[model samples]
Target: MNPKKPPVPVPLLMVIGIVAISFSSIFIKWSSAPVSVQGMYRLLFTSLLMLPFARPYSGAACALRLKDWLLLGASGVMLALHFLLWMGSLNYTSVASSTMIMALEPLFIMLGAYILYKERNSASAILGMAIAIFGVVFIGWGDIGLSAENLKGDMLSVGGTVAVAAHLLIGQKLVARMPSYLYSLIVFISAAIVFAVYNLVTSTPFFNYPAREWGIFVLLAVVPTVFGHILFNWLLQYASATTVSMNILGEPVGASILAFLLLGEQLSGLQWAGGVLVMAGLGVYLYSGRRKALKLQDSLPNAS
Candidate 1:
């Protein structure tokens, strides 16, 4: 018998995903529209772009039971909440602070994975996570605001992190049932609906935005939604959600660099130090994970 081939280039795709998602903060910062409106169109455009490709997977939806549909819908709502909260946070807090808060996602994800799926990381991986988180804190330590508005933004960011974690945890079981694209399509559509409803309730204008804002929306959908998140969703078929979240830790570093270049935001020596620590931690995490995977693979023959 032959060994099984991998379905996709997991590492390459992960890099692409991380890089793509790093732009999210930049695009969100450029937009002057309401957060709900941004999210509505981001997901809406994502759904429309995915529709043609996703139609082939339509039959997969029929095979899903009500529980699965409910899970998908719930995932969407959680995702919507995540965008609304996180994007809203940017208005009141610094990008570094918001992204730092978002870095807490892996810890949230690990806890949820263990609770829901009984998944656990190796000791080394956990240590790496700790190191990376410390780096993130160090980077954002000076930038964290003490003002009431900043506090509100930090709280909102925390909510966004929890929402995203919930979204991933809810989808953990369902991602295995259907194709990744199909799964993403349904979830995106559900999120779009939630955003749409929220916009309607708030009486926010749907079409008053200038061309630049519209471009931002489209870029958000294309870069982050398509190349970033959808790739991670695809990876869910092969890797644990915890692994994906670990990869997401790089987003702050990427975003920070982008901020310096594109937005002309200044980076301090402390930020650079923190960036190095974050990379080192991620290296350790990936090394541990890879070693464990190799050990598991080696043991398969003995078990057989």
Candidate 2:
């Protein structure tokens, strides 16, 4: 008889996912296609790749109510906007600046939760938000001294982060009632449709890209969308949310290293200082938020 197989290593897979996602900026920077076109093809390819696995959750998708469908559409639109803005940022700013600004995503999500759901935050979380904002401002100020174009890129990156936070907020509502795979599939398809319509209206040529660009699209789909995000989500079943959040904090460091190695990117003193501040703030923010959540969970009458 064959020997029994060993269990999968969740920690190793999480590291793989982080590494895969760290390539996102590098691939986007390499593509010369219009941001919209790239976003469209990436989502299209991602949706196609996910279709096979999402089949098990098709029943859940089909059962979505009208409100759920509408919210899903909104979520998709936000995702498309995020891709457009974030990718567009690459044209103007350094990867270090862009990724550092994006490191504020958890803060944005926290603020969104407070605004929309009345979720209160801890004092430490607020302090973390302030520190992170200061870091962003520091980076932005440095960019302004460098060139207005760089500043524009930083702003666009901020907008993109906000858009993604909105996407997550919408997902938080629906994921409780449906499979995450189904939620992700519907959102990806919706974003693809949105991009398809935008491209058609703008008369953007879809198939005019060279082979290299096509490969980047496929890599974006397979590496980040499938291996990075999907794998991370799968690992969530085993890891604490705190562990996952902490791991995500490593992305900027990984991406900056990759950018330096692959694209000959370098950070200045100001950028380095600001980057450190940003990561520090994000770390505090995530830690406090997770602690609060665990406390709340434990306080409940039916505490696990």
* Residues 1-304 of candidate 1: C-alpha lDDT, one tens digit per residue: 1123356666777778889999999999888999899999999999999888776787898899999999999999999999999999999987888888999999999999998889989899999999999999877887886999999999999999999999888776787778878888999999999998998888999997899999999999999999988888877777778877877688888988898898887778888888888888988998887787778779989996
Clash pairs for candidate 1: none
lDDT of 1: 0.87
The list of candidate 2 runs beyond 4 A from truth reads 1-18, 129-146, 229-250, 273-279, 301-304
Position 14, candidate 1: lDDT: 74
Instruction: Estimate the TM-score for candidate 1.
Output: 0.96
Return the lDDT, model 1, position 244. Answer: 77
Q: What is the lDDT of candidate 2?
A: 0.74
Summarize candidate 2's per-residue lDDT along 44-106 as a digit string, tens digits.
Answer: 999998888776787787788999999999989998998889889989997767876776676
**On a 0 to 100 scale, what is the lDDT of residue 290 in model 2?**
56
What TM-score do all the candidates reach, one by one?
0.96, 0.82
